[model samples]
Target: MKQEQFLSVVDRDEAERRFRAALEPLGPLGVEEVALAGALGRVLAEDIASPVDVPGFDRSNMDGFAVRAEDTYGASEQAPRRLRCLPEPVVMGVLPVGEVTEGTAMAIPTGGVVPRGADAVVMVEHTRLDGDHVLVEKPVTPGRAITWAGTDIAQGEVVLRAFDVLSSRETGVLAAMGVDRVGVVRRPRVAILSTGDEIIRPGTPPLPGRIYDSNQVILADAVREAGGEPVPCGITPDAPEAVRAALLDALAVADLVLLSGGTSKGPGDLNVQVLAEVLAPPGILAHGVALKPGKPLCLAASGRKGVVVLPGFPTSAIFTFHEFVAPVLRILAGRARPARLHGGEADGARTWARLPVSLGSDGGRTEYVLVRLTEDAEGAAIAYPIGKGSGSVTTWSHADGYFVIPREVERVEAGERVEILPVAGVRPRRVDLVIIGSHCVGLDVVLARLAQRGVSSKLIAVGSEGGLAAVRRGECDAAGVHLYDARTDSYNTPFLEGGLVLVPGYGRLQGVVFRAGDARFEGREAAEAVRAAAQTPGVVMINRNRGSGTRALVELLLEGTRPAGYAVEASSHHAIGAAVAQGRADFGVAIDIVARERGLGFLPVREERFDLVVAASRVERPGVRALIDELASEEVRAALRGRGLLA
Candidate 1:
């Protein structure tokens, strides 16, 4: 059968509008009563009512004697009153044997039942224990120490609202209400597959021009976080038949089948083309999107299986999933978006106060820059960007929330405060992390990995000396630096000698980036284009800002020459390759490993040591300790392999 194709291919926005318009609320998918102890992070399907009154009876909050309020009306500490303690007021949960007349008292313990005739409970601290009876010296008032039945919870009252995601407190509340089980929404099962021959698993060593498969790991985490049960089906070949089989198999057990990679319009796009043919008619709803990074998305409904084809890149995959799939699955599970304060995007307001730290722009697309925020002495919020540029998955890890700068404008200058929307909450606590040195590609990767290990790290790509200054001022927890002392040929230590201790971290490699089959060719001939790139008009040279290890390396490679004034200077290593990938830049300075991943060419440059430095006081912090261990792990070295910096 011939594959079905599209009529009008629109962009990301139109695709979202179409897909969202077609979504219908999942009708009563059924529910299960999960144990209260196991209900944390689960969405409550309905309002759970209290079957019975909490406490069930009038109870004493303290010990001593239960007495009538009228009997002790004139009693006081100085003018104390003594009352005879009655022996028979019945135990808790049992009816009183005999009701006492007024002017009498009975001994009661904390949480003990208050007899029917007693109006209040007096603590034992206020009574004297005599031979066979207790004497009350303090006055008692009606309902002073009594908790009336149904006071804590009313009968058949709604304890938790429907569509509420349960937190630990909610679970505890359910348990307190004597609920053993509760009905919760069913978790949607999603199957994920990483495609492309060039992508390998992290455990596998790279061969020739190949790289590790990180899409599965990242996408899986994002899925689980978004309330889906992710089933990673591992990496598959680029062949259309293999992809088809994987989708069919995943369709059997999953509500959604997500295939990563092979969506780009290159020769590899055969998978997308094949999907159109195989899942045609009532199947493929839309292919390609208006979204920036994840523009080449695919959405289809085949039988009971809904397929979402995401871009192979990590950040794009994450963004698209959050914006699209997450909302849908949450709807299916009867979930509501948690109330958060976005403060909306900036309006006509000019730059407010100083932004605490400097930040970059989003170019044209809607940008999300995760930031760490803190209040100043006057309690005003100060946003510190973890880093700009979404390509590095790690930046998202280190950020508390991203300060949004929408597409219509150009840039937010230094000291110009902006509204930073948090990744988690509107008022996230200030995390203590100090990142120093040049901003390179995927430095956020290192931060992301650190976060997975349970660290609340924040990154600021300050220069080497700049980081040292921040360290001396006690502003950051740890600073990342790759500053080279030409005399000693080492990184960070010399600058931080008096202020902090430099911890040797693994090295990441730097190289010149170009597209494949460029006329520039290889070796020394490649240098001709590389050397003249800065001078060449319309040429974009993505580089780490001055003081970065990458910039240092670039200067070392160019020797006495500077970037030709005609070239465009990009902010980061990933931005460089990204610029080159979509043809924004002709060539840029970045790591060799990334060049291969984005289908770009690499021109080798010098290497530098990326170091993590901590103040003397923070050496014992758990986050820093865990980081040291990770930096020393075989897994990290394996991940770093041939990146510019050395271990």
Candidate 2:
């Protein structure tokens, strides 16, 4: 891979342009004729015209007696005009063989053909039937109860326009209009290929840095979402010869090809080289975007076929798929790709509160940080970041939606509030992850694992003191802390003091957590709020409530340092982090673990033994035991890494 020719890296806009330009040369799949029944979900390829009126002759619209309006003039319940009953009857789907001569009535049901000389039909319900006779109870009007010809659909009218989707209702319309066949647009077929020596098939054991391929599956999903059929051309080890052969073969059967991985100028530059070779003089439309995660992108095409290559990173690849492929998919399917996910309701949740959580984003690109969202006490939206790293696959599984940070902004200062567009289909109320002490870096790993098992858990990283308070108040499922119980010479015992039972779990080192880069500089030991928004109107303070171990520790450090009536509360470590991020109140108290993942400024409060407290009544519950078991697993220790309260 000759050091991958030096090409200037462009940004997101350039990347999209290159990609779209590559795909533009291929023509859309035109209309194909098929049986009406088979075109149920396909797009209409041509207009359909009805040759005859929906009903060629006047017909009965209801089941009633038919009569001339003139014969019933002034005839009402007050004074009825009874007509001699003519010996005639009509049924649905059939034309009358004889006519009711002038001044005579005929019995006809709904949809029956109108008889000669019959001008109107009265409801059978509205009239009484006597032996060989019928009495009209209401006034009869001319043309009443009779459906005129061409009422539903007129002759020579276009029933379906070209490019319209053939819904069941649309299909029924054609059937009613006497159409036995339909013309539909052909479904675009896409060949999905995964290329790379480092990519492994799903379920295969990984070797060192090698990883199971998820890009292809995600890309295929993108293809399907775009209204194209995914042929799943499968994985091929990266070799220029192999890449060229596979691409050539895919082009023979596919309208387009989606290749995941190898868009970057890594050791596997074979994709770039081979695509350029196969695509002709103007091949390799573009390579290398300026976006943070997906910068290593590639686009290439010839007159007959096109190829879109995405970087190996899962999140980047997914984003790129939506960026480049989704539009084409819609065009080929002859429908617009929906901008919003299904099952979403118009959210009235405009008010949001800053909870104790940090934000991360790659520099130079608008990074989309995935988060778990929940509502606060007042039903305000609150978001917490999912652990992030381009390589962290867990972020994808745990996130409900993503928060976008604009380019070159490297950091989302803790407490700086932002909106999140949630992934559709999320039920925020079903979350179960609740941790009471300092937020941790890898807690998101636990969330992802839980999600993998089909569980939705909300991570509540409240501080050690907040944990105890929450546990006492029944605000959460579990609490973690490393509180020094001087009387017991142990961690967390005195915090439990009485009512709650401690569930045995492994121990973690707990302390102040700060941004990865701020590892060395410990900021001011105390925290304060710049302004108060909701709990009070004008005043704000980094105050603590009665139950927090962090507050107790803070009180021990500076006697009565908390301002009078300044007892403005921070609900958890995350809430405290928010206070700090927004400069709301002078430093409040918290452990270090929760602050580390956000790249925030953190001051170590103290080391505490993090523990989970089960309500006395809940101690024996199976779910409680399960919590304890999971806490004891190796995964928990991984979760505890860099969390504020760990000692």
Candidate 3:
């Protein structure tokens, strides 16, 4: 085949369809019987029909008197019906030996076997016992308090379907059905190989120009996360014979093989050419991709086994594996394709969060933006872009998830909502409202009120400026802000524009926060204490981030002077208070609530107004409306009262 055939970079959708068709004939893994105790998280290999009925005998649902239904007719509180009680009460796990005849009753405990000829049970609470004579006050209809045989699970019924992922609930069902062993699909074996001459394995001494083989470990873990058994083949040096030998060995034992690195069109790249030579005609289905960071992707298949050549970069290799490899693994392991919109929430494992900053993408190819989640002091989650390089290891540590920017979208403006697919270890949350900016403890009350109304919200602390910016871009439902204008001697609305609507949030007392026995503030006024702190040598002054309202106020108080630690910044009031409390700093500016909560001394700076800014377009959303109403509710006001944040 000509090299030109492999040069054309196919689109992701086209590549996906081709790979799916190619791997379709591979079929599911062979079935094996596993002990019910060991089958958790494994897919069922076949439908399991119960061999016997669950709770195979008729039983009482409650501790009561089991009797003929006709005997309890017309029994009431005012007018009671009397019956002869049996000598002994039937306890749980004990079967009643005697049958209840006409006008006779027997005490039956919950889950106790029902005696013959008993049609219903009258709750013991509804009856009074008088020396073997029972007075019934209420009547239970036939079959009302008794669970008939086979009612919970019928005999020979299909209790579990093929391809179902078994969890504790399924295990319990199996145990209840008396199935000690269950047929489950064997985990597909995936061979992971890293190929490159410059690649060095982990635990080796660092050498200049030599990179560690991180892709192998990443791919191995990814395969395991997707329910496949990983067989690590280690590193294969970039030689055709060595590559071919590794490929053949992997194919012999692995249902799927992943070769990371050496896929680019550069001189060292040889995975596609070697695959073509080894598999011969009609083996390499697709080569190259129209995706950023993953353009070097290659797909190949030999008989029932498949091979994927992932890009060299860590992020690109991970991205491509999830896009192409995970689905193939799922199919081979007898796991059904998760029903969802393409690139949408997978199996409903998605949470919507507002973008803190604008994201841009070329209109031609799909782009994934790495992001990290942050919660505001009020606990709403906000997502912000993280490191951009596909090879940056920091993304693995910092990012919680990634959101796909569709091919047609040129830019996702700041504050625009985006769907995020979470990283493996991070559990995803469903976000109802994206509230960005200013950290306020008072908002916690609003959150509780919103939760009581069954509304979910996510708060991202980006400071007042960041919140206002997000609101301006329409990325969030609202932004909590406490911007103070020195010129106007006012707060919040001074920074607002006509495109936004401000809803009154609360009033917070800004103050100087210091440790309990700090001498800098001893018997000094708010302004004098601040001046003394500046003058006192070796006293560290913690500051808030640049965009925060508290930082702005602190700057105003200093007036063009640089304190010892003015460059050092904390993101929230809690952080500032923590620095002071832990002796990391002598004093810092924070809200009164934080000072009180941290048991620190406080000196009042100024009371500032905090409010939520909403885009005109978002005011009508149900969550936005609920929040507005909640803020106005007396519950929020009462909670905010005396906390120096009363609305």
Please report the candidate that would top lDDT against the real structure.
Answer: 3
Residue-level lDDT of model 3, residues 1-647, one tens digit each, is 24654688899899877777776665577898899889988998876766764556666878889987778889999888999998876777776778777799999988887776666889889999888799999987766576545445544444566666776657777887788998899999999988888999899999998999999888888887788999999888888889989988888898888998877657776777788878733587788878887888898888657888898899999999998899778767876433311233223367777766677777999988877665442445567876324422234434568889989999999767888787765554444567877757687667756654546566655678988987776557899998888899889878888878999888888889888877778557888787766777666687777888887799877776676557556666765765576554678898887777668999888888889999887788777888899889887898889555756
lDDT of 3 at 8: 82
What is candidate 1's lDDT per residue for 578-619, written digit by digit as tens? 546645345667766667656677766556667777887777
The digit string of per-residue lDDT tens for model 2 on 108-141 reads 8777877655657888776776676666777766
The best-first sequence of candidates by TM-score reads 1, 3, 2
Q: Total backbone clashes of model 3?
A: 6
lDDT of 2 at 625: 52
RMSD of 2: 29.2
After TM-score superposition, what is the CA distance of residue 488 in candidate 3 from its true location, in Å? 84
TM-score, cand. 1 vs. native = 0.51
- Give the runs in model 2 whose Cα sits over 4 Å from its true position: 2-6, 15-27, 197-212, 336-647
On the 0 to 100 scale, the lDDT of residue 183 in model 3 is 88
Q: Which residue pairs collide in model 3, if any?
A: 380-458, 380-459, 381-458, 381-459, 415-475, 416-475
Poorest stretch of ten by lDDT in candidate 3? 339-348
Candidate lDDT (C-alpha), each: 0.62, 0.60, 0.76
Candidate 3 accuracy as TM-score: 0.50
